[model samples]
Target: MQNRFRANARFGGQRAIVALMLREMSTTYGRSPGGYIWAILSPVAAIAFLSLAFSAFFHTPPIGNSFAMFYATGMVPFLMFNDIQNKVSQSLMYSKQLLAYPKVTFLDALIARFLLNFMTQLLVAYIIFGGTMLFFEGTLSIDILTVLDGLLLAAQLGLGIGTLNCFIYLRFPVWQQMWSVLSRPLFLVSCTMIMFDGIPEPFRDWLWWNPLVHVVGLVREGFYDGYDGYYISSKYVMLVAMVCFALGLLFLRRHHRDLFER
Candidate 1:
């Protein structure tokens, strides 16, 4: 009887997640004109502009022959992290109405949002990276497994940070704004388009700790065959992600009801 009950609960959770994903698709994208296409175009346009604008200043990209490929390697992972983290951070508030249903718990809301956004970002990365390789002078060879590893790390880090931020953003509304202002520089310092080793001194040491930095480095290492991102510590990235995820669940389990009551 206990096993049957557990299986039913698991089945119900899957149904809840599917319902939430469909609702998000309709409301978030369906309402908007050119809905899903916008998801691909927005990132593509950004990469194109960045590639063109930076190419003029520097004779060549920091890594690959094509500016597009180099930036894509860096930007794709960063965008994956950025988009997933932001979406997951708002998951609870997003599915608040649905959560009133007994079968749909906060975990369902969190997982639904995370899964949708993570998959969307992966698709975007695929289009951007694949299209770049076809049209541009990208590296001849690629390491698919290495790229997958980096992308997975980015996804994990995003989910972890997003989970933690969800609780904090609800508990202290001002933190959302503060985090926005503070995180703006992440794009600049995360080594999205720059070579990490070339960076000098105390600044490099500080950036070493930013998990996103490690993610970007791992991704670039995947794209460029000869380049070794020796500084990247996958274990460190996983540790940070696991720690944040654990703390977030602990805090939310204790205090999530407080938010619902408000």
Candidate 2:
């Protein structure tokens, strides 16, 4: 009986997760004129704009095919992380109505938003990858695994930050606004636009501690051999993600009741 009850609980949770994801999807695109087309096109357009802007200044040769490939690998992941973080931060407040339902918890709302963002971002990454290969005739290599690793790392990092943000936003609303303002400069310095290898030695060593830099460098390793020697410790990245995830969960578990009371 206990096992049966546990199974049913798991099934119900999965159902709720799916329902929330669909709800978010409809609200995000269904109401818009172009709907899903905008989600697909937005990233592509950004990649194009960034590629042109960077190429004009840097004059770097194409690593795989065109500048698009280089830019997409870094830009898409970073943008996805940012999008997920923003959405997850706002998820609790946005889904307050849905939370009235007994089965849907605040964490479910976060997971639903993450799922929506993940699916869209994964599609965008593949579209850009396919488009680049088609245009430039670049061969797909084993390094593709690194891209997958980076995606997972980014998701973990986003979840940790998003979960913590949820609690912070509930406890102190001003932090949300402050976080928005502060994240921009941090994004700029995250080595998304430029390769870590391109940075001078002393500065690069100092910046190595930034986990996002490691994430970017790891992704770049799959594309360029030059980045293979870059000093990004994947172990450290994983450790940080684990710590943040644990703390976020603890905070949420302890304060969730208090949050709903407010």
Candidate 3:
């Protein structure tokens, strides 16, 4: 009987998550003119612009022969991190009204947004990366496993950080703007275009601690055969993500009521 009840609960949760995802798709994208196409185009357009703008400045991209490949590898992982983090962090605020019902909980909101956005970003990455490689006739060897690993790492980190930030943002609204401002520099410094080894000494030592740098390095390692991302430590990235996720759960469990009231 207990097992049956547990199975039913799990089924119900899956149904709720699917419902939330479909609602989000309809409201967030369906209402928009282009709908799902926008998801594909947004990243494609960004990479195109980055590749074109940087082609002159970088005769040789940090990774492969094609400027598009280099930027896509870097940008896609970074975008995955950025998008998932932002979406998860805002899940509470976005679904506050729905949370009033007994059927929905904060976890449901987080899971819904996390699953939807992660899959969307993953699809976008595959399309943009695969298309760029075919179009440019990229000579570099693409390590599919490493690319997936990098993206998975980015998603995990994003979920952890965003979960923590969700509670923080709820308790203190101003922190949202503050975090936005603070994260602005991340785009420039996250090795979106530049290689980790390319950075001069001393700085590389400090920048190595930033997880996104390692994530970008992993993506680049997958894209380019000769390039080595020996500096990346998956353990370190996993550690940071787990710690943040645990802390977020701790705080949220304790203070969720206050957040809901606010």
Candidate 3 residue pairs in backbone clash: none
| Highest-TM-score candidate | 1
Worst ten in a row by lDDT for model 2: 58-67
Q: Which residue runs of candidate 2 sit more than 4 Å off their true CA positions?
A: 62-65, 137-142
1-262 in candidate 2: lDDT tens per residue? 9999999887888888899888888888789999878877888898788878877877664455457777777776787677777787788888878888888877788888888887887787778667876775366563778878887787777777787788888889899889988887766677877777778978888778777887776776776654564487878878887787677778887987688688
**Runs of candidate 3 exceeding 4 Å displacement:** none
Candidate 1, poorest ten consecutive residues by summed lDDT: 137-146
Better of 2 and 3 by TM-score: 3
Worst 10 residues of 3 by lDDT: 56-65
Which of candidates 2 and 3 is the stronger one according to lDDT?
3
Ranking by lDDT: 1, 3, 2
Candidate 2 has which clashing residue pairs, if any? Answer: none
Candidate 1 lDDT over residue span 138-215, tens digit each: 545888888999999999999999999999998998999999999999999899878899899988999999998999
Candidate 3 residue-wise lDDT at 207: 91
**Which candidate gets the maximum lDDT versus the true structure?**
1
Residue 179 in model 1: lDDT: 95
The lDDT per prediction is 0.90, 0.77, 0.88
